[model samples]
Target: MSDPFIPFESISYTKRFLADCYERQSFANAKTVSYHTSYSFIYHLQQGRLYLQQAAQAPIEIKPMLLFYGIVQMLKACVLTVDPFYPENSTVLAHGVTARKRKKQGYRFLDDEIKVQKNGLFLHFLDKMFHVKQMPDEKYKMNFLLKQVADMHPLYSTMHNQDISIAVTQKSQSYMISDTILDDLHMTANRFSLFLEQSPNSKSWFHRQKGITALKQQITVPLHAAPTRYQSAPWLSTCDGDIYMLRKREDYCSLPELSIHYLLLYNLSMICRYEAEWWGELHHTFEGNDLPFIKQFLTSTTKKLPLLFEHYLFSINER
Candidate 1:
């Protein structure tokens, strides 16, 4: 219950932001299906944005609010899964249901990808994730995404689809599903911003109740695709297959209290490493350092750590 936003000095500005990261929900609330859907989506979206920056070789910026939105989307996807924690990964972990499934299946793909059985339920789940429901006008385009563009345009044309530009060698390599997802996400985020501007309901709730919109704003975006770093062997399939830990009461109690700080600290480390890697890449491309700009932006931005714990105090951890 201590502040998760205490900053570290050794890492880059992005890493600093990561080190200080806090979730709007506690591990207890985060383990539920509802939180999983909303939270994970937002996480996935931010990861998607990060992937885009990597592809473009652009300077990394920390937009915690935007990332929070992405985590929500990932949560939604996780809730939809048959087994929230144990979907098949490219590499077998020494833990739960997925490892058992891999052993039974017996066949592996060329790149050690799981030869996932054509389960209708699984495919249905994936379809929903890829297919966009809300259209601009409910017509014109079917929530256009990367799969659509890759199918239509040439490799070069596809590169220009995303706002960020990246140097890729192969046609397939250049086309990232994350880019397309971000386009849709940006539209929704812009719409949400407009909604806030127009309606006072945003402060309370559409129905006269206390809504968690303020808490939701903490994460910037959900993940569109898994991190590109996991695209290689061992982690490839798992990377593609969304791995979400839902907001369930059992899971919440299950997480050892001692591990909570360590778990969070580990993620903080990841954020730092990822940020440093991105910064190095940006330096390689752009020449002069922009760490100061990143630091200033992060320092100025408000964090939702207190709000996250406040929201969860009554709902999940009540005695």
Candidate 2:
């Protein structure tokens, strides 16, 4: 008996293996367990955006379904990128087992596992963002998050209902998402990125940690208030000059803390850039009140991301 699991360290290898299996119809009898890296999710996210762009031109009957799938892919991408160590466990059954034995043992579908993992990730994000605690009822938590997300972006409500129907019936239905929904998705992604930036080590839940305590001590400047009017330099004559600088400085006092901010910024910028490339420019996509710090940082060109961050961002899709 040979080892049942096949390990792939690179996306190219994974792609080739899948393509070969697909061509041979090997998946008809075999199950695939994808051990995806952070970069793999990012790649899928980029592809999802591409599908969304295509959905705009698709016929009305199928447009909603396309958009729904696209948004789901982006959501999965967010979960994976935010916490690459998710699921936290792996299992492999012995190969060459009889189909009858597998049936008797009650095998689990990889798709079901993915849905469970993604739902957990979504719940975690909502709990932290809304400051909810000790919600033991899984169905209630899921419904609560769905309603909140729908309220935040009305388009999500329709999509959510349609998705639920599709899941229950295992059939596709016609649905449509507005261009405005893309902006909502962008804002949601930014908010999650900000949460990740603020607490890098706070992975399990929203509880305070000793690492955050140490980091907070290093942040001497206040993060709540806007910069004073006279903080501009004499050499600079631009409007609202140095406001971005002040905000960035106030957010992170040390290089390590700044690195976290850079990581989030890089991820957000990648999403923004992808949107821009696919659908012209992004105008008023983000709200100032919702993410003032992110708006400021993105508008300013005075500061550059750390060299290491730039390297990792560009190399994420490399073979």
Candidate 3:
């Protein structure tokens, strides 16, 4: 059987287009990164235009206009450009990454609005995506990273909110969220992917290869394979910013670690709602008095994830 996921024609067309584009424009005409690899460079409107030129040459029906060579190969390496009128960084562009599925058909709906950017749009796009470094352990200390994560844990919410429901999908049939959510999810997943790809000299989770592998696998499953805990509590969807944090505490919560780490980071205590076995939220507070406990909490939570998947996988096989 053929590989269900790879788009063969699209890959061939992109390779050929890259060669022809470099030939016509000259090497200097394209952007350069610190590395010599062709895919390593930061893509701009010029590169986007080159892709457009290639699309014109081959015109594959499935290809998207804006594609990134991911440091790690996963479901999110390719992204489509949309709403060219909006600045590339506009949060709306992130919304373009969503894969739509109808419950009856069980297939992803493709987007139609993808197009190449002219070089003029590159700088503006870069401006929108600012780098946020891991807070120095000291900064996390200030923010009560330990307490923050504990509070954000999804298990707490699941246990507390009777209105919320938990359902697990099999690995092969996971349902995906909307593009806006997918865009954010992809960006977050890519960050972890690259983190794992790098050979880090400093202290980091990158050293944990198994954890990284499991985390990476978690993001791309079919909805039926992925367990989802959603809240039906009123006023929950309307909340934004810190208010969302507040309302989340009041309504429903979840860890959703299988989805992305940040989701767990944002709603730590919420995971308690998903699995009653979780006890961290009830025991810990962001009191600024304890750091080791918080650090231990982070370590334990991250470690617990693999077991969660093991249980999920075992349950699926049993079914």
lDDT leader: 2
| Consecutive 10-residue window with the lowest summed lDDT within model 2 | 165-174
Please provide TM-scores, in order, for all candidate models, with all chains considered together.
0.19, 0.25, 0.20
Candidate no. 2 TM-score? 0.25
Question: lDDT of each structure?
Answer: 0.26, 0.29, 0.26
lDDT tens digits by residue: candidate 2, 162-262 = 32110100112211122232242343433523443353222322222322121321211112222112111101112222121111112222112112222
- Give per-model CA RMSD: 19.7, 21.1, 22.5
Off by over 4 Å in 2: 1-36, 89-121, 127-319
- On the 0 to 100 scale, the lDDT of residue 211 in model 1 is 22
Best by TM-score: 2
> Candidate 1, which segments miss by more than 4 Å at Cα?
1-204, 207-271, 274-293, 300-303, 314-319
Candidate 3 per-residue lDDT over residues 1-319, each given as its tens digit: 2322222225443344344434443445222211222232224323433433343343221111211211111111111111112333454333221111211222111111122132322222222211112111111121222223322334335434531212212233332222232243234544534532342211221233333222333433222122211111111121111111222222222212222222222223222333223223324543332224323434443333323333322232122
